[model samples]
Target: MLNSRFDMKDMDLAHVILGIKISRTSNRLTLDQSHYVDKILEKFSNDDTSLARTPIDTSKHLLKNRGEAVSQVEYSRVIESLMYLMSCTRPEIAFVVNKVCQFMQKPLNSHWKKKKRILGYLNGTVNYGLHFTPTHLYNLTWLVTRMRTGHLIVMMRRSTTGIACFWVQILSLGNQRNKRYTVSRSSTEAEYRSVASLVAEITWIRGLLQEIHVHSSKPPIIWCDNSSTVRLTSNPVLHARTKHIELDLYFVREKVQQKN
Candidate 1:
């Protein structure tokens, strides 16, 4: 189609684009940035650094730094590198990476150690990548995790092949910051906001699919661990208790009514 309009040439095949390497098989296509991962590790990590099995320690709490900054510029550089990797192929470390990002301006020694731990984790799994396979079936699912102070939204899709793919495109970029600048009064309110955000993104994706002549036989499904949030969505009455989050609540209810 493009040949009939503007001037263009065929590159034939692509193995790498913007540091991401693509590999293909008969039934699947995979993307990884092993070279980029190695570069990041070598630039910021030492040769004798021990490998870490996980990106961050779950038991440890990362508090705001109150002392002097330790290599602030270098710390920002490392975060940028990891952010790119996290944006591209690595979704497992999204939570930890974003958690450390909160302290980028004045990172302390503890924050630097956390950054090194991420590098060590990467060193252990440099070959991890995203995989996609051919399939006729498509379903969209959103999983929202509500926390006391914040929330994590993960969108996933499954193909007929039964292989689940984590969709982190939004999280890697748009979701780094919260849509609502203020805090919600309750966890249910937070869940509703998250669900509304996911529905908005899914609507955009479904439009893109339609533009490309692709269609799904069913509407997207959202899987939330919170029962109250689910009940609120289907509940026809909006109580005065949820008046604070009425906007988000109405947005979600409207989408649900549309069978989205």
Candidate 2:
């Protein structure tokens, strides 16, 4: 953005391109820098770090340490850099990033090793940006003709610290998922839970998109492979099994019903 304005020495884009990721849609874009985290792994961690199945292992408990101390400076710098990414477009790393940052003031070798494990994860999914194009989004494969190109752009923050955020603007650019399962559960439970997990994210891009819409009359389109879930949401006749599910999962159903 610097070169076009007047004169800031057109430094090639390569320097700023810190081996992160870029996923694009007709209307928006997403940026992530997990690759640099991997580089940190190669530089500081072991090759055999166990891969975590999920970003945050809820079963794991981290206790406060009042043990032997290690140097805090390097730990601080690395943690700070990771925080910048976490606050911005790479919230997937927030758990690990925050965990690592916690040790910055009085770090330990063990804590440092944990930080390296995160880097190794970056080594694998270097370009895993979730490009959400109007065309790319198909909640259910049934509605294609209704799709239109949207106007959107994802501008992310780059303060090197603080919250990293995606400033998604929906102007007008665009004219603008699949799952198979054998389950006899309520349609709402199946579909809602199938959306991975909600706890991992603070706010979703869909929410951001809805915020930008010119009209609030229509609900966002959701396509589900499970017809039962659709039925559950549209017509809520709860049974024994579905009653066990959390009530918060109905947010989408409630909004959809209100025709939001």
Candidate 3:
């Protein structure tokens, strides 16, 4: 309190420092590695090295150092450096770091070369800074919660809160066909079934959010990768195709009618 005799030092946190770069302004703050990456690239002279479109080669199988041992001090230093970089600003370096760190106990010639390449890559990207926008705080959302688990309805908690708009996850389920629904159903029926799956997920997650402390605007979004499903959801009248479904379901219509 202003009335209490307490000493506080005002440290100005305004500029990027070390490898952990931070940028701040009256309205926003950003984290990144443009400067640090650039310095590392130049220091290791990797600017002219070929830049691969992708990071680690998907085909290459890299494992932890389980073969022989490399010089302890040198390998340890390199891994430590990479770990700092990965945690601070460059996660593209993570796989590379892990790949090399595995070799810390017993590094091979090939691993050493790859480590050098990673360093060079870092030098080229030091100035890179990750930008983050301010979070748009929102109030609560009014939507019923339902719980079901599968590939269909596992929307990320992050996106629901409006911080992240969308995220997609592909899951492998054991059952290829819906055992409950009859096969050879109309396209509308099939579409509603998919939405039923998604709504199950949305409701379940909203409930989980409440258990924690996450809320959203009314009527959470149900972004179907399938547009046909979207159209089917917009319609309310249940015909031969959708009559088998319920009004509460066929939620595409039920939800949009309320204005999300």
Candidate 4:
């Protein structure tokens, strides 16, 4: 009864909130921002750019521009828009957004082109949105993807749902840039670092759910493709090579031992 305390009128139904359009059906609901994407494209004068299938070009490596900045003002503006878009309904492009953000201070021409490519990709997938349906179980699974350069870490949570009898990503928990000053030496270290980050987020979520009186049927499971990192999680033996990330190892190991 918020109505009893405050004078308020009913807004029949929410078609859009914070620029995100909400579409619903009998058993499914979708959230998208096609209008916002179009506005971003038009504002940046990329309305006529060629459509790109992917958000970022993987072949070209994005590095710090040591040369003179190119349209730094315009570049930062586009990045601000994209960052908002990415946080709202386009978690799929989180990696690209995070990558381009690194060059926001002194964005080069290449960086500007990279941002344009993201707009082009959005042009092709304007209708793409996050879909949700009925689910019988509340099983949570965290998936972590390590970047080739061992710098970026993306984590998403997939909940097992009854609608399609398949795993669907229901939430994006993390798409964080590397806070550590030094990059990991190996792929395993990178994957392990990602896992540690995922576990920390999972722990926070579990605590929040508990506070709200929602409990999972079982403990959440973390999924990673790296074989070495997977083995290292349960392995008791610690090597000198892994001494640098010793704290991370213990933190993750303690959680695993508790079956969290």
**lDDT of every model, 2 decimals:** 0.73, 0.46, 0.50, 0.75
Q: Model 2 segments beyond 4 Å from truth? A: 1-30, 42-52, 55-57, 135-260
For every candidate structure, what is the RMSD over all alpha carbons to the true structure, in angstroms? 6.3, 13.1, 12.0, 5.9
Best by TM-score: 1
Q: Write the per-residue lDDT of candidate 2 for residues 9-39, one digit (tens) a residue.
A: 7554432355656655567566656566556
lDDT of 4 by residue, 29-133 (tens): 999999998898788854457889999888776666344579878888999999899877887787778778877777887777788789889888988878888
Ten residues in sequence with the least summed lDDT for candidate 4: 157-166
Q: Candidate 1: lDDT of 193?
A: 74
TM-score: the better of candidates 2 and 4:
4
> Model 1: runs farther than 4 Å from truth?
1-6, 66-68, 149-180
**Regarding TM-score, does 1 or 4 come out ahead?**
1
- On lDDT, the stronger of 1 and 4 is 4
* Model 1 per-residue lDDT tens digits across residues 1-260: 99899899998879999999999999878899999999998899986567999998877666664445699899999999999998788877777787788788778887888898999999999999888777676555555554443332111111000011234222222233233445666667766776767667778877887799877677776677779989988898989899887887888888899986
Number of backbone collisions per candidate: 0, 20, 26, 0
Cα shift from native, residue 153, model 3 (Å):
33
Q: Give the Cα error of residue 167 in candidate 4, in Å.
A: 9.0
